[model samples]
Target: MTSATRIATLVAALGAAVALGGAAHAAQGEGVSEVSVSGHLPTQVTVPLAGKDRTVVRHEVRLAAGFVCRNAVTNRDLEFSDLNWCSQRSRVRAMRRYDGMVARGMLTAEAPVIVLSAR
Candidate 1:
């Protein structure tokens, strides 16, 4: 075979390999849907009044935030391997809830905020 023909064949093989590699990579990701922030429902808490035995029921407030990966076909949540996948917006929302809980006297300001995925 001529040198020019050999080079051409090699180039074609490389191109085909790259295309197949990309297709395989895409196929591997086919099961995963777009990433999204997980939803959390608020819970009511009963707290005793300071210096008194009386307790009161506080309003509902969210206590955590999380990231969720779902299946593209079924829309069901799938396990994620890393906490880094959680978005900044989700973290900020959790902080807001924590602050609200403190402001409403449901929690103390020194309480730690919870991350659902981290737990």
Candidate 2:
């Protein structure tokens, strides 16, 4: 094969591999857990992330009910991976708390905003 042809093929293969790698990451990403809050509500709460002492701070939001409220984590970096990882970990921790609340009959239908504070 000509040098130019070989080079073009290599470039195309690399591009395809990169695309597939990204797709795999997207597919492997964590998903939101189901936590039904029928009535129990807190103005603010702190949820510690799994395997880490860091916690996520969640503020009560009127627009989104339950776990859909806005969230932030303590000492979170602005970088892409840092932001995404912190957010994901916070979400997971919140869901776990919600599940516990449900199990313990803490969930209510009042739909009040719960503020989650972390340090």
Query: Best candidate, lDDT-wise?
Result: 2
* Model 2 residue 13 lDDT score: 100
TM-score for each model: 0.28, 0.31
How far in Å is the alpha carbon of 110 misplaced in model 2?
Answer: 6.1
Q: Return the lDDT, model 2, position 41.
A: 34
Model 1: lDDT to the true structure = 0.44
Overall lDDT per candidate, in order of appearance? 0.44, 0.46
Q: What TM-score does model 2 achieve against the real structure?
A: 0.31
Compared with the true structure, the alpha-carbon lDDT of candidate 2 equals 0.46
Q: Relative to the unseen true structure, what is the C-alpha lDDT of residue 5 in candidate 1, on a scale of 0 to 100?
A: 100
The residue-by-residue lDDT of candidate 1 on 7-97, one tens digit each, is 9999999999999999999999989889988553322122222332112211111122332212211232323443334333344554565
lDDT of 2 by residue, 49-81 (tens): 222221222332211222222232222313334
* Cα error, candidate 2, residue 72 (Å): 6.5
True-structure RMSD for candidate 2: 16.4
